[model samples]
Target: MGELFQEAILVSILAATVRIMTPLLFAAIGELVTQRAGIWNMGVEGTMLMGAFVAYIVVTAADSLVGAVLAALLAGALMGLLVAFMTVTLRVDHFVTGLGLNLLASGLTLFWFRSYIAGRPQPTFDGFENVALPGLSDIPYLGEILFTQRGLTYFAVLAVPLVWYFLYRTKYGLEVRCLGENPKALDVKGVNVAARQYCAVVFGSVMTGLGGGFLMLGFSDRFLAEVTAGRGWLAIVAIIAGNWMPKGVLLAVLVFAFLEALATHVQVIGVAVPHQVFLALPYLASILLMMGFKVRAGQPAALGVPYRRA
Candidate 1:
């Protein structure tokens, strides 16, 4: 009986882990893609907040999941353009620019939610629903954790390989890295470094936006102030912890998710620890992971520093 109970608890933890990790996976992928293009965008959290707001607003307006997703992407792209324009084009400090952007996102969302939709009715919208495969979901212990999840979860999984190909397999990928390392060298090689940087940053923004949208539509039903929470910042840490690789990012997200799940379990089982301390476990672990083995060495040379055009 004790063994059976342990198995059940394990399964439950796995389920919770998957749920928490999905958003982190999405945000980490966004940061990874942006970094591969040679910009360390720490504004992922802010972009995520905007995306969440976009999703909530759009879903409330159009009452469509697709619409909500598209809106979030558009918002992300716009924000990406702003970042690229300031950091890549204007040659501003990437760190300062990113921080400013995050603050902007938070302020804007909070302001809009307060000014426009105070005391509004329940947002009428449907979100990404769990998809259960036939044979896969039939598995005894693992099925519930792996197979029964929203469709967006599959997208997050698929993004890993697709991102790898974009960064490693394609010619454009080479230019992005080149631009990050030495834009002057790429410029001499006749590569449009600015354009490449712009594209990479935008792509990252779009992914972050989608992740934020997913939070609203697939993860939660309603919009709360700062609904994106701190997943964006967590993703940035995951990016460093993942060693700037797509697979690494995925693994980091999984670890974070697992920690969150464990923390949740501890709280539920009345572990006698302060709930806030348990909640802080995943973040603490991420810090340790980033500090221990996966030090922030793989970061782009041009990260957080604006590139100057020669």
Candidate 2:
């Protein structure tokens, strides 16, 4: 128990917490935009999975990280396009459309993987390496935990403030928020409600895809079925638990990341607890957060409600 609190172990855990926070933060902040536009976008998990699978395929085949990331973004856009079509144009229930998309991505990726690797050893790729910020990374405990990480980790952290500015400071951002709170108001002003929603959904998905791509390139060496595990769902929970504010969402993601990081460290320190218990910590924390965190002041009024002009 004391070993767990050792300086070295503590630093390692905090650094790992930051690393683990990257993907969930990216997805949560991105989805913040989607939900703000009144699109429920239940397909985050599927879209992220698709992005990860695409990234794995492209990296293994081309050995180009840049190309793989781009492919992931494109895949996410396509998934987002489908989501937009169903929810915005066809007026399908957002929840149902998202659920269906998840199923589709899960099955499609599994089938494609099985076919691609028919009788061969599954290929793996070298993922991203840590890039320590020169002066910043030289600082004491904080530097190691915060400044030395994969490039995308920095971006994911910066994105929270950037997203917050976009949502609250930009005129277009106001229009987006309006779409979620009262689409009819925008329609009355001759704003193209559908177009805004489409853009918002696509933007969210593109970021979500990038998050998935990073998960593949930064962490895993080989692809597996459902490689994303439940991180995507955790992203959704972060948004809800954060009450839809970018800052709140960031904090929620950090909490989850910290729990996961703690779990990994527990195993390393030879905790007598069952391994499964450590693995379950983050999910259990999520449930508890949702149960106790009841403030909904930041939730958009019309979230999950589709808009149709009559």
Candidate 3:
């Protein structure tokens, strides 16, 4: 028990928590924006998987991280466009549209993978390197835990404030918020509700894709099918558990990440528990968090509803 509380082990857990939280934070912020705009996109998991697959492909072929990330962003945006078309332009049920997209992404990526890399050894690429902040990385425990991390980790952390400012302080954000509560009012006032919704969904999808790309580039040396490993679902859960607030979402992500990190290191700490119990820690923690923080308020009223302008 005392060994588990050692300073070095504690710092390692903190650092691992940050790394695990990065992808979730990116996806949660994007989902938060989409929900605020009154669109319930359940295909987040599939979209993330697509982005991971695309990043792997580009990186394997071109060996360019920039190209890989851009490709992922484009793929995610295209998926968002598809969702917007089905739910906004065609008035299809949002859930059906999202489910269909997930299925399509899953099938398409699998088919491409089997066709291209069939019987071939899995391709590997150099992932993003950690960048140490000048002067900050030198600080005792806090600095090493927070300052020395991958570039995407920093971006994910910075995005929290940027998203909050955009959602609260900007006119576009005001409209987005209104769209979720009463899009009819915006339509009556001559604001293009569908257009705004489209923009919001696409923006969210782009961010989700960036998250997937980071997972592939920063977390793993080689790509595997289903590389996202349910992080997308966890992202959605974080948004709900956080009551749709950015700071709350950040905290939720941290909680989940901490559990995941602890799970990873449980065996190393010489705990007497079974390894399987340690492995399930993250999911168990997620369920507990969701159960504890019931979403009784703050959800968009029109979420998951297809809007039909009269």
TM-score of each: 0.92, 0.98, 0.96
Residue 69 lDDT, candidate 1, scale 0-100? 88
Clashing residue pairs in candidate 2 (N, C-alpha, C atoms within 3 angstroms):
none
Model 2, which residues run further than 4 Å from truth?
Answer: none
Residue 152 lDDT in candidate 3: 86
Which portions of model 1 miss their true places by more than 4 Å? 1-5, 121-126
Best by TM-score: 2
How many clashes would you count in candidate 3?
Answer: 0
Q: Write the per-residue lDDT of candidate 2 for residues 1-310, one digit (tens) a residue.
A: 7889999999999999999999888888999999999999999999999999999999999999999999999999999999999999999999999999999999999999999889999999999999999999999999999999999999999999999999999999999999999999999999999999999999999989988998899889888999888888999999999998898899999999999999999988898889789899889999999998888887888888889888
Among all windows of 10 consecutive residues in model 2, the one with the lowest summed lDDT is 292-301
The digit string of per-residue lDDT tens for model 3 on 25-138 reads 989999899999999888898889888889999999899999999998998899889888888899888888878988898889889987878898878899888898999999
10 residues in a row with least lDDT, candidate 1: 1-10
Each prediction's whole-model lDDT (CA): 0.82, 0.92, 0.88
Which candidate ranks first by lDDT, i.e. highest? 2
Shift of residue 74 alpha carbon in model 2, Å: 0.9
